[model samples]
Target: MASYKYDIASGAEAFTFNSVMRACTKEVAALSWCMQHGLIAAKAVCSRCAPPPFMRRKGMHWRCSRSSCRVERSVRMNSFVERSTAPISKLVMVIFFWASGTHVTEAAQHAEVGGDGNVVEIDATSMTKKQKYNRGKKHADY
Candidate 1:
């Protein structure tokens, strides 16, 4: 069984459950967070003939602004969500559910995944990446 933890000491004030839902299910939220936090971006200068723009949403991915570049980047390229095999939506759903007072096991089921797991998500301002990484969160949903 896998376990997850959320850091909700004092700084995790901004992330309401609804916001998390939007981020997980909507490209705009995903892309917005990725770009705002610098999680995904290609070279400002294109490898091709034209200078590619910054990171922009193209369908389900963050691709080079210049459509011709064809450079698609993972939204989780560098953030906490980089390696989990689970769907982003499931991850976010479980985390929010847990924070909203749902039990860990129930949260995982709400995410529609098997096994028992604990999820802990702290506000970006409250905890450091090292702290989050230390809590056994091998993968993130959003």
Candidate 2:
């Protein structure tokens, strides 16, 4: 399991959902929250440079500190949100809603996946199944 900054043992009820929602309202705040929650790397190393120079945040990307190397990478690189096309705020809200066991339609509405007229169908059977006896792989070995 991933290490969360908050005490997840207390369950989703104890999670400060409102505070998280507020924090994620802005791009910068969402970035900060993601970093704090280990969703994004706070610091990154440049792969192009030998001995890997530390990368610093420059706008939406991380630039290498070494003047000679000058490598650049997206802030979302190697993170859960890396491939996501949605805004960070929406993604954060969706994740929180899912964690809190909110209904699929409610979560989708909150995340803005579908507008007032659009339909969002959720097939629960398509979701990953629980491991049986914790002995087999979660997915079928095809």
Candidate 3:
């Protein structure tokens, strides 16, 4: 299996291509090359449309090469990041702050994507309202 080096936290570190991509710039190309060369093993398959692919290397890193999948598309094209504008280095820094439990506003401030890259402000109130609505629905069903 292919191997990678990444510093993980004490608790569960969510395994995703984004994390691996955040870890190293070469991880993506390395994993993709590994998959092509049949050097890695598949763990869990994605349940989303087009079924995104996932490869695990000792549970420390992950890669998704499903080019036609939504997750890849979301990471590559959507979200607050542009598809080709921001540098991966800056994105990794943003991910680091996010992993450190910094709030979106604070992270956005640190990202500095507003001036050069398109930075979307996350509305905390909207998220709270959505959570409240979900809770109300669950209670009503009971």
lDDT of each: 0.57, 0.80, 0.47
Candidate that would win on TM-score: 2
Better of 2 and 3 by lDDT: 2
Superior by lDDT: candidate 1 or candidate 2: 2
Best by lDDT: 2
lDDT of 2: 0.80
Candidate RMSDs in order? 16.7, 11.5, 13.9
Which residue window of length 10 is worst by lDDT in model 1? Answer: 40-49
Q: lDDT per residue, candidate 3, 10-64, as tens digits?
A: 4234334455444435545543433443333324445574534563243223335
TM-scores of the models, in the given order?
0.44, 0.65, 0.23
Off by over 4 Å in 2: 1-14, 108-142
With candidate 1 superimposed using the best TM-score fit, by how many Å does residue 82's alpha carbon deviate from the native? 1.2
Q: Which sections of candidate 1 miss by over 4 Å?
A: 1-14, 18-52, 97-102, 112-142
- Candidate achieving higher TM-score, 1 or 2: 2
User: For candidate 1, lDDT tens digit of each residue in 12-41?
Assistant: 444666566567676456556445545445
